[model samples]
Target: MFQPTGQKRLTNVSVIRYKRGRKRFEIACYPSTVLSYRAGHLKDLSEVLQVDEVFENVSKGKVAASGDLRECFGTTDRAKIIRQILERGELQVSERERQYGLRNSLQEIANIIAAKTVSRATQRPIPVGLVYKALQEAHFSVQPTRSVKAQALEAIRLLQQHSELDLERARMRLRVHVPAQHDAKRLQERLVQIETDAAKKAKRGEVGSAAQVAAGASVRGGSDTSASLQMVQVESEEWLTGGALLWTLQIDPGWFRTLEQIVAEETHGSGTVEVISLRVLHEGDHLNDVL
Candidate 1:
């Protein structure tokens, strides 16, 4: 066990990049106490703490874990965060949710329940029995908790009302094929108008930003058609004499459905949006590159 020498306060926390391209994050405290995790675990840790990146202690002050964990310079917080991340990662959406699809709220709730269950469990390799016990204790109903599969499905259905976590996921790049009936000039005008409205929505705090709203529109079909928009840039536009015009949009997943809907509406049901590729955006993915 890693022991603490003196007081418990965040001393140093930094992300270590290895020569072979491996990365690790280490959180330290006064004296020599430290907690470390692999790069893959960083996402969950950051999500639990609501931080984007583990900064070097010199630039910004060291961040203590929230609540009780802040006072202790031990592995408790690190282990708990890692365990939750692992459990949530292990969860897979039910075949039914995959086939019939889950409502957005359900998906969010499912994620929360998974995180909470893993965090609450006392034993390692958290057993299905313990999961049921936790859910029952917390009054989180997952019908037929006898089996893991049944429990997961039930949890997804019942947990749709839990607290939300703002975590960034992968972004999808789309090729919106517009009908030839909409000329290049007309398409440009519509795109501009769409983005203009996005800016207005951002100014009103209806969305993350003008960019998020504009980009969200291209991916999800623009939920708030007149207001919300994501910050996405048109990668390229290719035109053929009589064929459809292919316009590429790179956007985050949060507004993907909205983007698809808006495009269909804009094209008057004549246009179609197809995902060309998906990628997780990194800090290096600058606005200029995306735009």
Candidate 2:
């Protein structure tokens, strides 16, 4: 052993091991970083590796022989060899770690849902616990490697069909055809202003009513805005012929009437608002039960 484990510190260390012939190469990596690196979300090696040095035996802190690097990679450069090891190595993830990751991802999906959705009747943001209960009831198979937003969308669909809880998505998905160029601009500005005001109120701890709290909630991965990134996100936008605009929006259900007013005012009652799907939320009592 080159050094005792007590003498070294590698917090949350996970090993990525590569083998060639009788020689085994290893790198100490950040446990949390391996999945992201493997998914290609992270490219920089420095961000992944805990220590730059390749190891013959990581637990013992024994460095690999220089000749082995040349034999395997045809180069003695430590950085290059480490890169190859990282690329080809099998990351060692235990069942426990995987379960932990699954839990975290499930919670994240629940959070995004809570932030974006509300009770159809009360128009209040659903508590995180209630979202989890719905997920559990729906038998959502939480996949840690999957996108949370995509999972959230799927969860909504599943909850509507299978779970006891119901949601209001029909009123939220609006297909609008603005008759003029300026009308689209006006509609976007009005919705943005509403979101900005709500987000500011949320930050200031002014959640006085159910509607207010729902409006104040943030869209975790839904909107592209810098500040509020609020509701009424543009799902699709296209400029139509003869100076008109067509749009598909995913918005807060609570804003349906306000949206109707905005659309009516902007297009002077000429634009069409198409509705897609609706699943009623009649679970305020259930939400309390879960909480």
Candidate 3:
């Protein structure tokens, strides 16, 4: 805490941008800095005013020698923002609460407000920019939050798009070793279901089959269901006589891991789940021969 004499009163105002580019207003007048007073007893000039309080004091013209700070911005909107703060306090939705990164502040208030408003109005996410229209309809004009909300919504859209592609690109080839005591009937049923699902997806243009590799460079081929199925023997002495199976599965990588875990758990940790190959699909690769 730095002290100033009565004749040399000093006032310092600092604006800091924090998480999600939210602004935090801090004012240090004569006694203490905004963050310093929270540390308990120190010096005479140690009482700090946080931004929310600053908003109230500044709006009322209470603090002495704050004319310059007061004149820096339009008073009309400041009164509205302060009023909204006093009325709404902070935007909070219990049902929309997440277990992680819960925040309460003015910085992301617009984003939260827009997201909630859109979700409530349409039961889905609308563009963040559109939130301004909704706010306008509600007679609430907060421009900063509108811009922040729009950016946040755009970021969310990009994340969702990337995640969908990641899921589509997670296909893999599993080389599984069957236990000697494993039931043959169950394995056949599982294989049949896998082939059926593959054919369905292929028909929908959702994936390409390795069986079409030699016929063309791309996955597009004739309606031969056999194109998605391939088998090879494991070069192990124990699996020399049809004891092992190698099959390619086109699925999200996470699903494959989950399936592997289930198999391991069911087999009392005796089953083998080996990834023979993992493919990163591109536009052309899906149509080309099996890698």
Using TM-score, give the best candidate's number.
2
lDDT: worst 10-residue window of model 1: 29-38
Backbone collision count in every prediction?
Answer: 23, 2, 8
- The residue pairs in collision within model 2 are 167-279, 170-277
Encode model 2's per-residue lDDT on 1-291: one tens digit a residue.
565542343556889899999889889998788878877999999999888888887777777888888897788898888878787898777789878888888899888777666665465567789889889877799876579988987787577568766554422566778999888788777777866787678678885543344464334333344234355656567888887888766556656667777789889999878776432233545321111
lDDT of each: 0.43, 0.71, 0.36
- Better candidate by TM-score, 1 or 2: 2
**TM-score per candidate, chains pooled:** 0.33, 0.52, 0.29
Regions of candidate 2 where Cα sits further than 4 Å from its true position? 1-12, 19-23, 35-47, 120-123, 170-291
RMSD, one per candidate, in order: 21.0, 14.0, 16.3
Error of 1 at 238 (Å): 0.9
Q: Of the candidates shown, which would achieve the greatest lDDT relative to the real structure? A: 2
Per-residue alpha-carbon lDDT of model 1 for 1-291, expressed as tens digits? 553432233322322211111322223222111122223434434443323322223123343334323333234465654343333222223455433333333334444434333221121123344434444444653332144445554453343224222122334567878876454446556656766776677667686642444333333333332232344546666776686677777665445666676677777777788877655233333422221
Q: Cα lDDT of model 1 overall?
A: 0.43
